[model samples]
Structure formats: C-alpha cells, structure tokens
Target chain A: MDNYIEIIGFIAAVLTTAAFLPQVYKTWKTKDVSALSLPMLLMFFIGVLGWLIYGVLIDSPSMIFANAITLVSSFLLVYYKIKYQK
Target chain B: MDNYIEIIGFIAAVLTTAAFLPQVYKTWKTKDVSALSLPMLLMFFIGVLGWLIYGVLIDSPSMIFANAITLVSSFLLVYYKIKYQK
Candidate 1:
C-alpha cells in the first residue's frame, strides 16, 4: 500500500509537472506572452517556491522533484511574461 | 519546524493550484484552446490523478486539497481544448 501510494505520488508529480511543458514550448516557439497573465504567473512562482520549501522540510524527494520542475517551468513563463508581454 | 513545513506546504498548494485560474479564465473568456496542447493537458490530467491517489493514501490534507483543485482546473482545460480547439 505504501509503495502503491508512492507510485501514485510519482505519477502525479510527473503528470502535473509535465503539464507545463506545452505552455513552455508554446511560449518558447512563439515568444508570445501577451495572453499569459502576469498576476497568475507571479502567484504560481511564489506558490511553487513555497512548495519547494515545503518539500525540503518534509524531506520528500517526490514533492521536491515535482515542484522543482514546476518552479523552472513557471519561472520561464514569468520571465517571458515580463520579456514578451506588451 | 514541522509546523513551518506544513505551512510552507499549504502556501505551496494555494499558489500552485491557483496558478491555473488565469488559464481557466482565459480559456473561458476567450473560448480558445488553439494554443493549448492536448498532449500536455492529457499528461497533466493523468499526473494530477496520480497525485490525488497518493494524497489519499498518505492521508495528507495539503496534497489532497491542492490536487483536487488542480484536477478540476486541468479538467476544465482539457474540456475546453476538446471543445474549442481549431
């Protein structure tokens, strides 16, 4: 059961974290952030940072790994939001 | 220290989960899913589902709550992608 749960966590992390890839790809390919929301990106960045801290404190590698990727993905979006948004 | 970690997790949950709102709003408002990738959305949906199971198994409220909201938001995106994509 514990192993099952861990597997679930791993799957969840992979899916959720990877979800941002499309946006990242689109943002990268188009270099367009006009439609992306700055406030939303900012909130996500802050939130992912919090998750990273939380993962570190809990010593959960699954959480850490997932949030770490999420952080980068979201950060890129935020960066682009600033760089490309009109 | 533990409390602090929990707090961090809570904040992380709030931020990450809330991060999807803008997209949801945009999708709803614009009724456009052209830029959104179906593959990515599908992966994210699967991943969040796994996280939900993990949360249930671990008996963690923070994880459960965050993933639950994420599930809804992502699901909406997926629904819209199917509905509005060109």
Candidate 2:
C-alpha cells in the first residue's frame, strides 16, 4: 500500500513536470506568446522556486526533483514570454 | 525550525496554486488559446489529479489544498483551450 502510494506520487511528479515541456516547445517553435500571461509565468517561477526550497527543507526527493525540472521549464517560458512579446 | 519549514511549504503552495488564476482569467476574458497547448493542459489536469490522490494517501493537507485549487484552474484552462481554440 505504501509502495503504491509512493508510486502515485512519483507518477504525479512526472506528469506535472513533463506537462510543461509541450508548452515550452510550442512557444519556442512558434514564438507566439500572445496567449501566455507574463504574470502567470513570473508567479509560477517564484512559486516553483519556493516549492524547491520547501522540498529541500522537507527532504522529499520527489518534490525536489519535480519542482527543479519545473523551475527550469518555467524559466524558459518566462524568457520566451519576454523575448517574443508583441 | 519545523514551524518555519511548514510555513514555507504553505506559502509555496499558495503561490503556485494562486498563480494559475491570472492565466485562467486571461483565457476566459480574451477567448484566445492559440498559444496554449492542449497536451499541456491535459497532462497537467491528470497530474494534478494524481497529486490530489497522493496528498490523500500521504495525508498532506497542503498538497491536497494546493493541488485541488490548481486542479480547478487547470480544468478551466483546458475548457478555455477547447472553447476558444483559434
């Protein structure tokens, strides 16, 4: 049961973290950030950073791993948002 | 120390979850989802649902709270993406 729970958490981490890649790729390829909100990206970046710190403090490898990857992708989105702004 | 750590987690949860609102609001008002990736939203919704289950299994209130709210906002984004597809 515990193992199953752990698996669920791990899968959850992968799904959420991996989900960002598509958006990043789409934005990178098209350079169309018209629909992306700057405030959302900015806040998400900061929020993910906080999650990273909190994960470290709690010593949760899954949170740390997921949030770290998410941080990078979120940063890319922010960069794209600025560079491709209309 | 522990209390501070918990506080950090709480704030992190609040930031990440609250971050989605602006995007939802923007997508709702503008009806433009050209830049929004459907795959990302679908994956995110499933992932957040996973997080909610994991939170329940682990009995983590913060996880449950954050993911639940994020789940709703993510759903809205998915709905908007479909409804406002360019």
TM-score of 1: 0.88
For candidate 2 chain B, the 10 contiguous residues with the lowest summed lDDT are B55-64
Please provide, for model 2 over A1-86, each residue's C-alpha lDDT reduced to its tens digit, 9 standing for 90 to 100. 87887788788899998887887888899999987778878888998998889878867667788999999999999999999897
Candidate-wise lDDT, in order: 0.82, 0.85
Residue B86 C-alpha lDDT in model 1: 74
lDDT of 1 by residue, A1-86 (tens): 56766677777788777777777888999998877788888898999888778777766677788989988988999988888877
**Most TM-score-accurate candidate:** 1
Q: What's the TM-score of every candidate structure?
A: 0.88, 0.84
lDDT of 2 at B29: 87
Per-candidate fnat, comma-separated: 1.00, 0.85
